[model samples]
Target: MKNLKIDREKVLLGVAGPVLALVVAFLLTALVLIVSGYNPFEPFELMFGAIGEQDVQVLIINQTGVYYLAALAVAIGFRMNLFNIGVDGQYRLAAMLSAVVGAHFSPPGFLHIVLIVVTAMLVGSFWAGIAGVLKVTRGVNEVVSTIMLNYIATSLIAWLTLKDQFGYQAEGSNDLTTGEISKSGWFPGIHVSDLAGDIYGFIFVAAGVGVVYWYVLTRTRFGFDLRASGASESAAAASGVDSKRMVLTAMLASGAVAGLAGMPVLLGQTHTYSQSFPTGVGFTGITIALLGRNSPVGIAFAALLMAFIEKSASQLSYATPPYPPEIADIMKGLIVLSVVISYELVRRYGLKRQQSRVGRELAAQAAKNRKEVSA
Candidate 1:
């Protein structure tokens, strides 16, 4: 009963942060709308109404999968006290190379897909490992190394996708692309309704990744070591945990997951890496990871919320008395800011509550001791 109560309290406290953030964000966004001579409630109404459309629903779910994967990648580094800011570079580079391989080869049925995914993971890990190696060997900060790597990766992709290189211009289109993968290599999608289109089959893969992430972090000795090292390297060292190795391992794991972020679109939809391929997902992952508090379940919800906001934002300019599409961007920015402030506030409040409880218990014990002495 005591344990259950403690767990319940922890859950409530955990939830309090995000809830407070959303409330504050919504209010702030409304104020902005009012100042801009727009109806704040109308935007919310339209956004909520957009959810009724089957196609929009499908888009949200599919995008959520991508966001979830990216956020998970970021969360992995966060858990190890490492800031892997290059997830964008890692995943983009992985996707491009993997797409090239998929285009060039067609193995057996499922084996083809497996090969592409494995290739992507390997590429992502390799890229991220550079930052990790630099951090451990040369005492480089991951933030600086990863940021530089992102630029390097971007330039590398641009070069590799040139017409004479691994890329080709499709007839009737000027956009450069890594030629399409064989149909056998394409991931199958789940059909729901004709209007809705197929949901990305890789969503299941994302879910599995989340389950694995939760299990590994909570159930394994390595997870404990990683967590301990993140909490305090000196304390972890005293406990015989190797901090450098853990940092490297975390980066590798993070990059591997980052590799999967683009597979949903590549295998399930586009079937190729092109100039139009999505970007900035890795940076968005950082926001989601922060908003999710680095938990799998929390990240899932955060991903959905972000996806919904993005999808809903697309219709703003087309609506009656159309609002600027930038409204959504404003809301997102406010939410991020609100989340940071709200979480800090909640932390301080919880700390004070805990301290008060401890003081009360001490006082009660002192009173009992005084009574015993008088007797």
Candidate 2:
């Protein structure tokens, strides 16, 4: 009963912390908006108004799917204490190479799409693997290695996108790209209505990735190893878990997922890799993962919240009073900060209370045994 009660309390904290974090976040954001001479309530009113629109709803859902993939990408690396800041690099490199590969091949429909996705994953894994190798083999910190890799990935992409490289200048245009992927390589978008855009075909793909992530992390020995290594590498090694191997596996999985961060555009909308293709999504994923506390369900909620904020902020341009989109950035930052602060406080308080409860229980048990023995 005592253990059950403790478990119940844990569940309560899990729910309450996020709720409180958002509360604090909004409060802080309101303060900022007031100080900056913006009517904070007006922005939210506009946001809620836009949320009622079908086109905006579809846009939010589609973007949430993309953000989920990105957050999952970062969360995987984070699980093992590996900061994969290089996710930006990993996904872009994968998308570019996969676009090139898809352009070069003309396979059947299903196979062509599958090959493109697989190519992205392989490239992302290899790119992230370099950071893992440096960490394990040369004692380099994963954070430093990944950060350095990001710049290298950017440079490589710049070089590869040049005309006469993997890409070529488009007809009558100055833009260089891998060119349009054939229809066979396109992931078929789920059409909603004429008023709204099609839902990203990769939405299901992201969902599958989340399911696999949760299942593998909770149910498999590899997951056990990964979690143990994350908890403590020395302890994990002492228990016969291969720390180095876990690092490599974790980094590879992280990068592979990061690879998908670009796919919603590559296979769903753009069908080509170019300089204008979305970037910085990897960084945004990191913030989302942190806000979500790195759980599958939490990540989903966080991604949706993020998408709503982004789309709603963008909508503010046409709102009655016209609030700036920069306010959205402020809100996002505050939420992340509030979550971190609130969770940390919760952790310390919970730990102390647990220790006190354990002490009391032990003392009570000792008294009971002493009285019985004396009698």
Report the Cα RMSD per candidate. 1.0, 1.4
Task: Tell me how many clashing residue pairs each candidate has.
Answer: 0, 0
What is the Cα-based lDDT of residue 276 in candidate 2? Answer: 94
lDDT of 2 by residue, 1-375 (tens): 978998999987787777788999999988998998888688888887899898999999988998999999999988898888989899899999999999999798699999999999999999999999998899899888989999999999999988768887877998889988999999999898998979898999999999999998889999888988998999999999999999999999999999988899899988999999888888889988888878999999999999999887877888767777888899888988888888887788888988999899999999999999999
Q: How does candidate 1 score on lDDT?
A: 0.94
Clashes of 2: 0
Error of 1 at 23 (Å): 1.0
Which residue segments of model 2 deviate by more than 4 Å? none
Per-residue lDDT value at 239 in model 2: 95
Best by lDDT: 1
User: Candidate 2, residue 327: CA error in Å?
Assistant: 0.7
State how far residue 268 of model 1 sits from its true place (Å).
0.3
lDDT of 1 by residue, 36-127 (tens): 99988988888888999889999999999999999999999999999999999999999999999999999999999999999999999999
Clashing pairs in 2: none
TM-score of 2: 0.96
